[model samples]
Target: MNERPSRHVIRPSGCPGLLRVVQALDGGICRIKLDGGSIQADQAEAVALVAERFAGGVIEATNRANLQVRGIGPERDALIESLLAAGLGPRNPAGDDVRNLMLSPSAGIDRRMLIDTRPLAEQILTTLQTHERFHELSAKFAVQLDGAEALAMLEHHHDLWLSALVRDGEPWLAFGFAGVPLDEPAGRVPLAQGHALVVAVLELFLDLARPDQNRMRELLAEFSADEFVTLLARRVPLQPCPDWRRVASTDGLHIGIHPQHDDGVFVGAVVPLGRLDAAMLRGAARLAREKGDGSLRFTPWQSLLLPNVRADNAAGVLARLQALGLLVSGDQPLAQLIACTGSSGCAKAMADTKADAHQLAERLHRRGQALNIHLSGCPRSCAAAHIAPATLLAVAPGRYDLYFRDATLPGFGALQAHNLTIEALDHWLDAHPRSPLDA
Candidate 1:
């Protein structure tokens, strides 16, 4: 195991990293960023072990496809060291916080992928970590590389987004700034120049953005996209792509058996409320070793996928995942519900959102309704990246204000009701089965 480095070497940030454990209402939070959302089985076991030994055994699969161990005690160094030994730490300690890149969980394996994005993703990730200039980026500054996978998370916005495209029978990447792949792209680059395009964009952002402008959107607010693209053209070759728009990804593929590009299949299951116990993770790792490839991939939807399982063993894998306490079917109400760490773990939270979500899930299940609902403890809406069809924002313990997503509105969208109890909210939802809120 590598020796623990001095505390000064770690960056000062409110966010948690492997080398920097930030204090929380529950305990310390140490986030382990995975490469392209992939982790080997042995590394996962190491996470489970240290979580059980040094923390409360409460592990979270974050919305960004990373794992964080919560409720950690003072043995923070030991936990971090163990994870580093398992190969979870960044290439250098200084690079940890800047390593924010999102790729489709099925990057290489997705059957509908236009190109395998793993290789380019690796190149981009390494540059993000090792390039000292890139380290100046805010911890939240992120990039997304999409292989045009059918299982992609296309809704989450990023500082920069690149999606695979084919023109004239040759693969190219269509990229945009401060938006999702679904947005119209700024330009296209040859597949071989994808890495250069990413580098050029980041360097230009650093050169142009003010100290206060930590995100691309913030910078773009001051400078127009067209103007920025015009400037970017001087750094790298750019091609017009006015006609390109990313296709929307299919949903529910993250919670069931799905075929990969090869003959094998991948099984996916949701971690309940985005929280998992050590046993659950260990069990999943064991399944990955026995029935699938010796690796697991996490998705932005807070789910885990075990890829390369034999087609015949897919059913057994799903059954075992269900036994491990993961929601295996999208129809399960818990699978559709997401909740943030509420009063139990976040000082900013007004109520125990996780507990309330469980109650809400049971009520929805009893009504045979599996609606996409987000239970946020506060306005930050940390539980969801995209607005859900329905949302319940906590106002007090056991009380919430309901909102239905409206493209015409902002925040959690139009608030439909205020300060209703869980039971009352349940009845309200049932009463509006035919409403657009239920769509």
Candidate 2:
């Protein structure tokens, strides 16, 4: 347990949450964990203001659907206080790291949702923050609560995943460990017991795991999920989810106008390569204040949406989003690419992943290849939570080792190329045009 650096409960983590500003090669990074990726218009504007004033104005929307202000300086504490003042801090000071519950951006309003997950998600988030024991959990430890939303992100794995499903005509949450909702659930619980199940799982993890085993997957590496669930039964009610298949979500639901379960509409837009300038953020905030509900919800796909928009004005909102340089169409190749802060900003980076991704995007656009590509500076793969269809792991200044996603293999799937330039990658991609990676 002393793997923790010091004799303090809230030990400093390398990963920055709202309260912590971690030092990076560029500057201090202050991560703002949004509740289910939703931020009120005023809160968004406050973020814009603080970022511009206290940081270098390089704001990043993380893959997990949160915001981070990069290039922060000596004014880090003031910046943190300003954000906290804006109601962006965790429920408890010690609970900041443990508040890693993720929900679908379209949780309540998605057309295909079987249950409204926001209420349950809110309860879980509150418990994760307010519960003192969970404060010791890793900041990266995360949970996914899915409502069978058509706009859900199924690829990004989580420590624990709970997906809505029907059992004998009643709503139940089919849950799993260290995987996505698409994976077979280890068990199920009634909608009412959802929070208790999460609490039990987290408590069991804390009880059974050493400090090094900060994640559910790490604990699972030594203990089986069956064992964990069996132990969990002693603490909370557990029911086997015999017949549950998480419904497949639509791919393009993260962009353009989408009809909600109700008569309202939602306008979605991609943030070109997951990076947004001050104006882009402020503009989105203004739009959120004006057209739709006065709130914006970011998605794991590195995009955002204005949910509960009036059906009549959805088209106009989409056009305005496009005019502001957000990608309103999913067909755009650049929209599919994700690149981490490369050599330009990160000391660990070899090649510039962001710049390389741009070049790769141009090549793919020319070849009419539609693929989900992730460019990582190092093995950390900071930009992508899951192994993308294609990955360019940087090995040198301008060279990278390419890998294609293979489910059977671990860690970036099957290695394709040793070290290739962007030009060489284009050739390889051109050769394998119809590969499933490109589909």
Candidate 3:
């Protein structure tokens, strides 16, 4: 007989974990963090099954490339057991919350990748989970390892980032603290020392940070990044990384068929509003098993990639995904819009952002315009890790404050309009055709 999954004492946090199901307006939510966003078809099916059997059949593709099962009932332990049986749980119960590492969905497959980050990522992940001290780290404390992939999510800020770079015909990792990979690196280390450097940084952080200082950005607020780097050098050898800036990644690589460095192609499709019904997930898993490599890689854009699909079979896979109601094209207005679980699932939500998003998409499609828009139920901006080009902040039911992302302005950027209905907002967006909202 298979042993029952050991239930661990749930920790106190707003975030959910595989073992820690946080209660939401919809019910309990269990977050399953994938290693490098990759899940086998069998495992994906397991998730689908549990979502249908124990939850309300709602699966979310999170911005970090993880999956969450929402609307879970009292059978939380049974649901956790099912996921743990599928090998989706953390190495240890205590380690679940600390495994907040992000990787490029196209890690080893991207044609533009300079290094295969999988090996290093595995090493870092193993350390993060097995190192008991790391459990002290905050659940939201995240790290990003970029392999110079064209399909990478470079805009999302991380507590620590190591981006692959070539120096003197050798691969090196450009390191930065409390920022995205696009920022100027604080220093560089040999690719081989990448894991050691990460260990050193985390240890240094834990030693220097107070109990209240959980994130690197918070610690940096009190201590200078340069000073911290100066201290880190004594622990890990580092080299100057002056004039090194990560090249801008190509946009929209998360959707549609994209060529891999290898012979096979990757078929990408975005989940409508980051949601997948049980049927949609099972269909995708079946497609992965039949046409692709039998594995699915979720993307930070709330999309999933059927990697290693034959170039010839890519079209068929994409067509099947579209038939399943997934958005396969970036040009579709619905594909460009993202909304958080609003009043339906979140107590903090003032408006039904998802319903509003659907209305906005229809209007934008009618105008033949597709702009990246984020609809937040509140100011927390839980759905998006980075700022979208345009944001609609809900103030009241069916009414929102509009803002366009500005280089200079803070939180949700510069306000453009206040408390406009979806219809009025659509008119404003149509009138400002060439505004940053369009970008």
Give one clash count per candidate, in the order shown: 0, 0, 0
The reply for model 1, stretches above 4 Å from the true place, is 1-8
Candidate 3 lDDT, 1-439, residue by residue in tens: 1122355755678788898888888988899999999999999999999999999999999999999999999888899988989999988888899888899999999999999999999999999999988988999999999999999999899999999999889999998988999998999999999999999999999999999999999999989998999999999999999989899899999999989998999999999999999999999999999998899999999999999999999999999999999999999999999999999999999999999999999998898888899999999999999999889999999999998888798899999999999999877866877887665
Pairs of residues clashing in candidate 2: none
Off by more than 4 A, model 3 = 1-6
- Tens digit of per-residue lDDT, candidate 2, span 1-439: 1122122245666787776677778888888999999999999988888889988887788889999898888887778778888899888878888888888888888878989999998898899889888888888899999999888989888999999988779898899989999899999999989989998988889999987898889999989888998999999888887777887888888888989989789999998888887778999999999998899999888899998899899999999999988988867888889999999888999988888888988887897765688889999989999888888899998899989888899889889888899999888877876766756
Give the Cα RMSD of candidate 2: 2.9
Write the residue-wise lDDT of candidate 1 on 293-402 in tens digits.
89999999999999999999999999999999999998899999989999999999999999898998899889887888899999999878888888889998889999
Candidate 1: deviation at residue 117, Å? 0.3
- Return whichever of 1 and 2 wins on TM-score: 1
Q: Each model's C-alpha lDDT?
A: 0.92, 0.86, 0.93
- For model 1 the local lDDT of residue 123 reads 94
Error of 2 at 80 (Å): 1.1
Give RMSD (Å) of candidate 1 vs. truth: 2.0
